[model samples]
Target chain A: MLKKPRNGNSAQHKYPHVGRTVSLASLSAHLGLSKASISRVLNGAPAARSIPQVTQDRILAAAQALNYRPNLLARSLRRGQSMTVGVLVPELSEGYATLVLAGLEETLSAAGYAMMLVTHHHQEAKLTDLHRIVMERAVDGIVAVDTSLPVIHSTPTVTISCPDPHDGVTNILLDHDRAAELALSHLYALGHRQIAIIKGQPFSSDTDIRWRSIQIAATRLGLSLHPKLVVQMKENLATDEPGFLAAQRLLATGIAFTAIFAFNDVSAIGAIRALQAARRQVPEHVSVVGFDDVTLAAYHRPALTTVRQPLRHMGALAAQSLLHSFTSGGNHEASHSVVVEPLFVLRNSTAQSPALSLQC
Target chain B: MLKKPRNGNSAQHKYPHVGRTVSLASLSAHLGLSKASISRVLNGAPAARSIPQVTQDRILAAAQALNYRPNLLARSLRRGQSMTVGVLVPELSEGYATLVLAGLEETLSAAGYAMMLVTHHHQEAKLTDLHRIVMERAVDGIVAVDTSLPVIHSTPTVTISCPDPHDGVTNILLDHDRAAELALSHLYALGHRQIAIIKGQPFSSDTDIRWRSIQIAATRLGLSLHPKLVVQMKENLATDEPGFLAAQRLLATGIAFTAIFAFNDVSAIGAIRALQAARRQVPEHVSVVGFDDVTLAAYHRPALTTVRQPLRHMGALAAQSLLHSFTSGGNHEASHSVVVEPLFVLRNSTAQSPALSLQC
Candidate 1:
């Protein structure tokens, strides 16, 4: 779905899960960093902590960068250790959330900290509804994904999938800006001059960064930043609307772009469907590229060339981060962030420029 | 995952997110009977209550049916109220879980019941680790799906998607037995006598019932059942014991069965992959059918024909049952068992038995 144009409260956006109980040791191991450092960072007790300043700085940075509020109840519970952590995700069944959850559970369980999971429906995003879980000291710590963050007084939390930064929570995110740069660089290196971008969702951190970076990269490569060729996508809207909206406008008022870069795999799928609907043969007529190499990308008729987010790694990392928060005596002084790089996967969706009649 | 061939409680299953709530209202709802009646049934306050015998019976039945157990701690705190309900599921985040949870959450939220979710991944069925989620007054009631049940003090609780009478919990389920009967009966009526049953995960409830029903139905129809005709599948087994094992076994023996009935769409997928690997045309050399009309079922190359388990309705009903238990005020009354019917979806996977084979 496209990112909503409006910004709700971070808490409202990142709903909390109320039915879990988390402990410091559980959260610490979930973090996947050194336990000693996790303890010193969370406790702020200022004992003879012996980690390097840089490492400690990264931990602290990670904790602060996440979009979640700290879980304070976890601090008290950890002092009286329970050896458990909590995980709350947007939709656990999604490939990304499931993978991360599996990673977190595996890491924490290995560290003797069990995981209590809370999966909320789309409606539970209300700030109060989401907050109720953590306020009751259900879990020692939390790991949140895609779903909104919680208003936590004491529980240490982490959020992933987006590049948003937080104060006390750790964030594991994708560098969309750099990813777009690579996409642009790859296309330019392939001798493509005039390119069009099918912007994914209107207001997503990822789409926003990619769009901005794509324009910047095009300008640096001496290519024109043509707005006529830019196609903006609306979230949850029918896939064809965006493709038709872009295609109709492009066809009526001819553009010189030779290649199109779409926001995500879904949008690219829409583009292909629309192109076929318009009797436009893919690659033979116009080369296209997409982001997020989802499962069905390879199954498409022409197959899709896309930017691959390290979803499996991200999934596992999210789990590891949460476990780390639970294990270190529930102390969260170490703030850190884990940003994974994206891969440019080559498939049949993209190709060399093709001849076309540009009436305009 | 294989269902462990074991009886109740002593198994090593781990259910997380349950068994830890100190709230009131949530407990009363799992009974699905009524709050006032639940209070009377649970508190043994019949002396002051003037309700009829039927109401009392219903209340008691609901409590007994759901295995309603009130949390003593919350009751003591709130003068007899535990606002939390514990929900344990085999694992959440799968496509089925997504729909089921949507139903469960929608109902639970409307009834004003706060829920604690426990999703676990057990290597196998022995649910001995259930002690972590049970053995406490944290929650007043419980609801489980595809997980092992705990033997203990009955608290209004329910279980779904399993074969056992689930001890004392309300066992709301889809009749896999009847579903299999319907599938096989339809195929037989279509003049398919030389049929093969492609079972999944060895001894799965759906598969086992299908396996037996095939034999029983074939007997009733006066069709001889062959030993090589009933094939069990273990497609991604860890043991290098013929990976994608079932399909290979079916093709290796070179025993020809005109019609094939797969246990589920997943195994059917494995079968299709197997058929492709073996260069056998589906519905030509072997007419195929599967169970569980999963989304991908309708999209397969030959478009698999399978049994549809009203997944959305089943999920909704399961959620509604759990919500009913939580809201009607923990009345330990009459137990209710709901059996939903399955439908046969006709597609290309099955056809009339070949005339050449029919004469033989």
Candidate 2:
């Protein structure tokens, strides 16, 4: 015989004004079972093994019949762990951010953490979004990629390629200076003293660093640094069109150069197109080098010679730092920051400068 | 006079073993105010406007000193709105997925929803991950891209290019058959009867549909698709290597075909590379047409003529479905599914058949 529910007649009034709301207590009472037993079966806890199979079946049937849904927000509040991290990116269509995001996703998922993704195309909106994410406690931590906005919070933040000197923020900076040196040095070795540099955007983190490095390295190697040959992109983002226009600008200047050092692989391909359009053969009329060695870089016509940044590794390290901060109870000091070195990859794009042949 | 919390010293014992946990009640007591008033000030409620500035300042200072957090989980539980959505994708590193994701992010963020991202590389794992996402109540709704996984649950699901006959699940399907007709018809109009097809991955959803359409269109146009000329990739993903290898295999067979229809732009570029290696001039010796006019297709040495799919539009539609379902109280009937058509884009990679040139 089942005992009568104390509030059976008033059960309709208990959760009024809704189209069927089911709670653990309601399901427990309906199935004539304890709330603990219902929870075990519903959550599949270890203690659920002690419950009889018949009782578990009954509980499940009752839950389905009533459309029971465990309140996730309430459960998380009780557990004091959201088990989610916020990821901020400027753009997802770009290969650099997506590649990094892949690695970040892999690591976070392996650690049983979900990633909340938010993108802000404009720079000013990024800070406002960051503030909202923190104020709402939307995530346990944050990892920002290719964003210039600094997370000014104690929310255990990790930034990739976005250096913020703010205390407690761990920055993952790339060694772009080394990448520039490698490209310049390779051009010098190929007997090319006069080279054009298609600089990246003014607002990009790599532009100033790469340009400064190129200048110093050129000076040290006793090579000519012609101001007319350098083409600074007029925009804030690096795309093939800007690269195409930049190469055209360089060509218009008519300063002779045997090689071109592009800001990145897309620009290198664009520069090659401009050269080909002028009836100039790559590596015969001009050898081109690029940076960031995107997937298309390897498949481009001349198979670009570029500097490969460890994008995935940087993403992994950023996730690892945030994870460490979580486990260490928000210390944020254990892994303050990290710097990764870029590598030089030689391919068919670069060859012995045409000046050597002309001199011969 | 600061009034002690009604619960008093036992509050310390209630939440023991933590590094400075501050709740509304604790902050209220510290600031000599009620929890309701403190909540109003912190949450910026209408009642907060009536509170004195001095009292508000005191409350804020005390809360800051105690490192107070509003327990967003509890707040959301009471509000009955998570304001978050889950995004499931096979790969984020792929250009197609990232492009779709950019549009999805734009729409979802504008609608004030956060996206929880998860990637399942293997087909079998997608269902399992979907189950986990739903069971955990990780999001209020879901948008799956390029996945064949059916959203069996009633969690307001929207899928792109993945059709499920199941009720209440909205699918955003692409018109691959029309795209195939467009490509084959173009080649046939150029007086090419024997055509080669670089098929996409065997397991991909579009591969079979596209191939079947190609065969039907070829039959209708009185063209022959030679068995020896078809190259089916072993992998389940499209990339440049397989396209290059497939073109090489066709070349080795010595089968005479004046035109090639590649599965995508990447594979088309690869096929062009293989043709170039064999000293066959594109559009001079053979005409090539690719699908999905990716950004690189335009910048490629011989700008590829291809079919263009509106990936960003599909993404936006999928998001719209999910958002609508949310507003309609998960009815799922508001917008059941959508089918988007692909368009033909003519470029430099294709021209009059080499056979016509030879005859002339």
Candidate 3:
């Protein structure tokens, strides 16, 4: 498909890969110096030979003018580091994971570290394979994005959004309990009593924590936390399919509820769809809230009210922690745990209880 | 956060990073064979060093039992290949880019190639920096996701959703013309004569192509193509903010259009919000159509009517093209451009024109 651009300006835009193929011999020839002298000067070798300082500066300027970038493999080999960080994600198709990865990449790149992306596809076998490959081969450090695995590498490791840890590992965790409190407290303040909750996938690392936190908070507020009002989704919470199915099930039970607290924005959207299908108007017949204010949360119809977990910020912090541990050569300085707070973003999704509206 | 597992089964699950560190000396001692013979056998040296077949099998079995993985850098150094691929993206936060990247990673990993992820952040300086670093590093092949650049290295390269290539580069285009036709034709078939299009960022690689296709198709169909009805969105089409602002401007223009053809799903969603805010009922007052039926498109309110691109498939094919070129040692075998077709998915967002409703 590649042909010379018909436009003249495009031809002048130098392609990314056409690097300057400058070698020691070329540098030596460009300047009146021997290959050995040019190499010694460029590499900053000790004064084994008395090369004039003026000649050295000239050689350096020529090399710079030629856009000379040192071979990374040779440099890494000499330095005993790959200058790369391995990033492990459970899946790449997820918006949440990808957004976090973008953050990690930004920080890692600025710090002169490349990222090796590895996805486990939520399969134990694939996770094992990725772990073996990443641990046995490259990457100076590792960052596991939203994964639950304990650190087992001799190299420094950091985790994002995951709560568990192992020896010599730093963890960046989201305050799940706080997120629940923010959502439930908001609903409670709005005079909601029979508030239904949509539970996340049962086996997820955060599901129990979030569920227990909500349960505890609801109890403290004297609100009913019953299994009949709790909807269970499938194993994959990222997709809306499980959310759709679970909401449909909740509606099928003929349960009466004035408000719904969905596990995430996707689930909230799904619940809204179900409510619409049943000819129930959102925030008029029932109110809905969600967690994880993803990019789509703000754009969705009714503009989902959700608890936002600074995904990008968490990613950046995790990358910084890994770099610090790897550079410091000890996990002690970087092993400290970081707990990031979640914020409640109010939108049009939730409103006053419909029973109160009817009484008024 | 690190603590002992509450369940006994958790203790049995072996950690992924704790690799069995079996050395050459241990293998030799266990099998009662010399280190030189074992090394030659394990390295698969030719018949010049004849080791017994039984001994070779025994050694291989032991290595497998011990779960030994060879050092990738040392092996690559010996073989003069890095066994890794560099993947470049404009940004990682967008669903489109990350979905394609997931496909690329899947194929590359299956073929024993680790992926080095580089994000240019849509900045010339970052692109230059990434180009310099990747070119100087150890990557056998390259894949640019949603980027347009000429091939600059002997290493094979494949681009996804990008047109206009240089020699020896294979482009995986999305058939933007077809996508536009699919969207425009669908709206036209629905009895909509006055159509407004939300144009993507003017400087994007596909913006012109998509715009031209829409213009040509609209003219061919004898449809009114008015500039007053058109909306110009911000450069970042993946985010909803630009779409929101652009749609607001179009609404402010007071253009009497029955339908809208947005640049992408994000833009379509933003348009929907604007239309709603203006007291316009979708499909009843105005119909909205979008492109690149992202995952959220299906979950969005009114279930966005849009064109779907096979993003993951494109990623896999691009990776395969690069691997084929690199492994075959000739760009000829892999320098074939592939254009994937887009599918039109009908949903609630679009319906018969309001003029038709009045007539009926």
Compute the interface RMSD for each candidate structure: 13.8, 7.7, 6.7
For residue A165, give model 1's deviation from the true position in Å.
0.9
Candidate 2 regions with alpha-carbon error over 4 angstroms: A1-72, A134-137, A252-254, A274-281, B1-72, B248-254, B273-281
What is the Å distance of residue B313 in model 3 from its true position?
1.7
Q: How does model 3 score on DockQ?
A: 0.30
lDDT of 2: 0.78
- Complex DockQ per candidate: 0.06, 0.40, 0.30
Task: Encode model 1's per-residue lDDT on B20-50: one tens digit a residue.
Answer: 2322233356544556556765677855267
Output the TM-score of candidate 3: 0.85
Docking class of 2: acceptable
> Which pairs clash (backbone N, Cα, C closer than 3 Å) in model 3?
none
* Candidate achieving higher DockQ, 2 or 3: 2
TM-scores for all candidates: the values are 0.66, 0.84, 0.85
Candidate 2: tens digits of C-alpha lDDT, residues A209-308: 6788888888778887898999887665546777888889988997788899998888888888888888888877889998887787876667899999
Tens digits of per-residue lDDT, candidate 1, A132-226, equal 54334344566666554535445567777544556767788787767777777777766667777787554344556677778777777778757
DockQ comparison, 1 vs 3, better candidate: 3
Residue-level error in angstroms, candidate 2, position A26: 6.0
Q: What DockQ results for candidate 1?
A: 0.06
